[model samples]
Target: MNFASAWNAQGPLARQRREAMLARVGQLRALEQRAAERSAEARAVFEKRGQLLPRERVGLLLDPGTPYLPLCTLAGYLQDAREPDASVPGGGVVAGIGFVRGVRCMVVASDSGIDAGAIQPMGLEKILRVQEIALQNRLPFLHLVESAGANLMRYRVEGFVQGGALFRNLARLSAAGIPVITVQHGSGTAGGAYMPGLSDVVIMVRGRSRAFLAGPPLLKAATGEVATEEELGGAEMHTAMSGLGEYLAEDDRHALGIAREVVGRLGRAPTPALPQGGRVTASLPPPPGEGWGGGAPQREDLLTLMPANLREPVDMREVMVRLVDDGILEFKPLYGAATLCAQGRIGGHAVGFVSNNGPIDVPGANKATHFIQWMCQLGHPIVYLQNTTGYMVGRESEQGGMIKHGSKMIQAVTNATVPQLTIQCGASFGAGNYGMCGRGYAPRFLFSWPSARTAVMGGEQAARTMQIVTEAAHGRKGQRPDPVQAKAQFDKIVQVFESQADAFYTSGLLLDDGVIDPRDTRAVLAFCLDTIAEGEAAQPRPMQFGVARM
Candidate 1:
């Protein structure tokens, strides 16, 4: 029982065991020192690039003085590596649980200094494990991605494959209902693009970050098209064309700042009861045409303000600003010119806006889909501005799968639970009308300007209908009717549609709620907002679905 008596009884075996334990402790201390050195190296690389390392990013994302529970602490083995102690979890990616603005969040960030942040099969497994943690904990996920692509060199290793597991993890993350915010601080190419695409929000820095499914070299070799890195997948491409990025920052710091702000907005606890002494509808403006100094401006005057041709252009921003609050925060303004969206205070209450472009055939129908889905999740009212001639057509539209995309928009709007209010400015025709949350879509209130044109098709399509009718009227056996008289009859038929006015009298039946002046849009939206806010009781959080593209 005594220490010396026990040691003497054990003899040589006890001495050997004691020495082995000491040796193992020394080995652990050495490993710890190496890990520290590697972390410092990683931090130095980021500092040289004027950026924060993965650890620093995590710290910034989490609340001050919070501890991070790391998921893994070891990296995989690699053949022919010179340094014996080169591998560790910090070498691949740093992932853990932390608090962000007091809300628990799962944080995962790539170690850009090691292997250029290339994701090996092991690293993919680690990321998936972290995603699982987020799901289990019901914590919002944040991915600070700065990677090149899959680790091609690791393919030869046992249990290694070419396709990484990040894609599958992304699918699971989407289904878990944990909101993922992905930030691209540097190059994000090939497989790296999927992480950001799978998240609810993607933030990218202008000059420091880029994301692409294919890089320039591969593109040039495969298609004989040459492009620079920036041209291939720069901030402009994703933000303006691909619609993959939610917000564009001036630099890396700005991007991180934006990510923090977005997470705060999304993670705030729902208010169960109205604040004490708070007015129920203090911010709401009165109903349309009530307590007003002057009636809304005439629809004919608004028509003159808009562009003439569908192919031509006008700044829909001007129209939105005039209709909504003074400071409208338009989201994805540079992407999809035909679709417009924004989140802003409508009569001092947050609301979502989805609108159609009158000048282009871009079926912003998909934007409407995203808008409706967003509203359902946020539990906010939606305002739609309708001015579309119809969904885009022709070969280009077909190539983009306009029909499929347009259908999704229609389905989202019709199925949405949130209060939707639509205003028809001029033209609302074809499927575009329904996608814009039209009357048939069951908006709480559907109003149109006096000059609004509501129909199954546009005037040009109506002209064709008249032409076909006139041609059919003249049979082969009988002499053709007088050409001038036939033309006059066609004109008369078209005039009936023109004089129909607003959404009513469509198909020779009353369909619309009624027409309101253009200037009354704000008042209408304000009243709708108040009604929606007052009606709904507190509801449970939304169920997660497959990842949204943008």
Candidate 2:
């Protein structure tokens, strides 16, 4: 049945919720702008050196008019700095998926504007995550390299140890038949020298590029030898003698142009081609928004579908209508009302949709397990809209084998062959996160809404549970709990849990790919689906080892 008749987009509650959500969206945009502005502050410095900013370099490399979905822009927010107001997000990197020529590539640029593009701990993690994506999708890895390398003063042994993976991934990308391209715009000293050394193609700017294992001072100190940067690892030296760079240019703009030319000439094949001479006709599904109904459900209603209070129940089908192309064909709707299992179209792509109306009961877990397997059989990707407190707990649920059934659901999520995507729509607490394919379960991509909160359990629930345990201990010792002291402790625990559970806080640690606005949910899903579709149809040649520099 169509959802048009059931939805009330103009309702008073809907209007109020939409306003609240709009305010959250504005705040998200402002944070992203803050990072951009931080980088823009270095424009004068860059211009004086006849160079372009990191973002300007990225824009020049990408194909004009194509969509660019930036990822993890708020990572390190309130994490690297002491105060929230002083925190600069993005982990000193600018990364996303965008087009180069006609080919979609994973583009990563070092935000040298901030701290000279020093590798922040979270920045290293961000690069690793995106590199994993490139490998999984078989997309080309394009890097705009210009780093002061790891900040020596702030170095951690763990960061230095993990930094090796950056070079390793570059090699792996080449071995997987995914081209690793680099444009060296500035400093690439010490460990950073390996960035371009591992790439399949390296484009360097003549006067600006430097890729030395050690600068002048270090050289003299180590071996009593004196050598200038130009003599050691300048672009001209590397291109002419060291064989580290494949192409050299006179300026930053020229280097980026050479990068574009190199990509254009890679001779990569398009998506899987049809059989040459067979009389085979493939039947494709109707375009989005054409089959079940004419238009999409009002996205404005999405805000209202989720109440301000996480404990309040919501009809997730209201959310489904706004995201799906037309209407949902629900499965086992009567069998497990708390868990929604349905088939829907997202941008003409058939995806099995799972959402939670409340805690997953025995039947709800069973229903999800079966739906997941069925979707895998049909080769359809699964989308999880998580808003769960966890599986049902208490006497009846335990007797009904909740644990075993929940295990089945988690197992299904873990081993599913098709790609899975998750949106943290509301409360994702306890084992429910595992069952819903949360970050730990490794969904292909996971994003959260501004209102989403993730924790082992709710703050109040956790505090109350601890309080009960404390009272029991005191009773065992023949000493009653001091009510004032107990309440103080309870409040402290709640505050800590609640603060850490916020979406922005979790995102700062790269817990999710990024936090997205609820209104953009459908568009994000469509873009991601398109990306997965392209990768699935691509055929890349794999080698035993990555291409190595001679």
Candidate 3:
């Protein structure tokens, strides 16, 4: 047969073949459009959650306009079975090289909508792959976690064999001194919590997030006790009681913002400023009021500024701001309201400030411990403002582990080698005094203000002691005096406790060096700093022991 005749005879099948090819091409194009739509929807969902998507988060965390090098564009293989979704990058765990605050960082962000962000067998492999990347590059690893848990069914099917490799990788990164920061944007339950907990810093948003060893249902089943998510693992729970996390945020955006700031602080090059001299001291405010002995300012102003009644309270933070440098950086500022610790430049040199609110005891001590630890790390000087009544006592105090935690503060101060300057503002008595880095604790210089009520106990205790003594004398003499006469006798004896027999008495005994004006505190600190600088430079080495975990 002729070639043309044969082609015509086969025309029906050829036409059908061409039509099939066209149909497949159209189908693929439609799929591409649908995928673009789905991605857009995913971005929109992230916006609704007040969070940036994983890719966008990576972009913002890195240096401006820096491009991210994705770790893997597809999930890894199994023994022989091909994963239907193997084409997806990282199998829903998006990991790659990025930057935070202009410093290089490696990131692994989970997309919850994808398999509920569960760590399937393949997912675990992906996580380990990224961890290896971080360690190899010597970059900080940032985890944006919103995971339900390991894929339980997949894990069972695989004989629970996928977790060890991932955890080993985490331990390796941790040992390398490459910091890891985890941001819990949503539910972090089951095995998921371990990923973040292993990190150096854990940042969490408020209502939209939770993190725990297990979810509520599992806990209820395992323990037969039902607890709300917040009770189990909320921001408040972690920040205040457990101290599992370093920072807490009101929302995802806030968490990310703090992450950026923290990365900057951690990654900056250490540049210690030069020590200052007498010229710097001269510029400081005058000492406390005239009554305290130093010629700077009056201690009486403190009494008037504070209410006479003990029940009335003053904001110690405002007092600290007025006394310290203008550019103070407060730590755990929201978690502990009663204590304030900050790092700032004093006389152009970095120093740590530890101050307390009279109404709050252990929190103040806790804050002080953290400050001292930070100072030790930086090899900087520390200044303590002692203004606590005493260590808090009561049912609440006991539950807070006040005694043990407060002891930690005292130990930290005693062990600190940095030049510690202590200013007794008011009411430094009992254990609280020693915990405040008292004179006995070997401060470089200990100065008390005239208004300082430094007794073995507070003024109220003095009044009580006087009342008891007078009552005993009256009973022994068999003489009942009028209320007026009794009042006079009690007042005279109580006055003994209030006068030089107090802090002034200690000063006379040389237990306390002397009192200084409150306003002159700045000058005094500057002078101390200059003196320390003249005698010796700081050791230039970290303390060997008793380092508090950050």
Whose lDDT is greatest here?
Answer: 2
TM, every model: 0.45, 0.94, 0.42
Best by TM-score: 2
Residue 224 of candidate 2: its Cα lDDT? 95
Top-down lDDT ranking: 2, 1, 3
- Residue 114: error of model 2 in Å? 0.2
Per-residue alpha-carbon lDDT of candidate 3 for residues 313-368, written as tens digits (9 for 90 to 100) = 54544445444445567777765667767777665567887777664466767877
TM-score of predicted model 1? 0.45
Task: Candidate 2: list runs displaced more than 4 Å.
Answer: 1-5, 269-297
Q: Write the per-residue lDDT of candidate 1 for residues 1-550, one digit (tens) a residue.
A: 0011111313453344334433433443344335435655766667777887655666666655433334343333222243545444333676655556655567788877667787755566557666654554456788999987766665555433434556666666667555788898888887678778777789988877788878888798889988888888888778888898889988766887898888779835532322221111111111223222333333112333343233334344545665544557766566675687877667677777777665334446666677679878998778877777778888987888987888887788888877777777668877777888776776765666544577777655686687777677676546676878877877776776555532323311223433443444565566445434533432325445666685
Which model is ahead, 1 or 3, in terms of TM-score? Answer: 1
lDDT of candidate 2 over 1-550, digit per residue (tens) = 3344375778887777777766766777777777878988998999999998888888888765555667887888888756877788899999887777777789999999888899999999999999998888888899999999989899799999989999899889999988999999999999999999899899999899999999998899999999999999999999999999999899988998898888888877532321121110111111111122222346556766676668867778788878988788889989888999989999889999999999999999999999999999999999999999999999999999999999999999999999999999999999999999999999888999888989999999999999999999999999999999999999999999999998888999999988876766877787788788888877788899988886
* Total backbone clashes of candidate 2, pairs 3 or more residues apart or in separate chains: 0
User: Ranking by TM-score, best first?
Assistant: 2, 1, 3
Query: How high a TM-score does candidate 2 get?
Result: 0.94
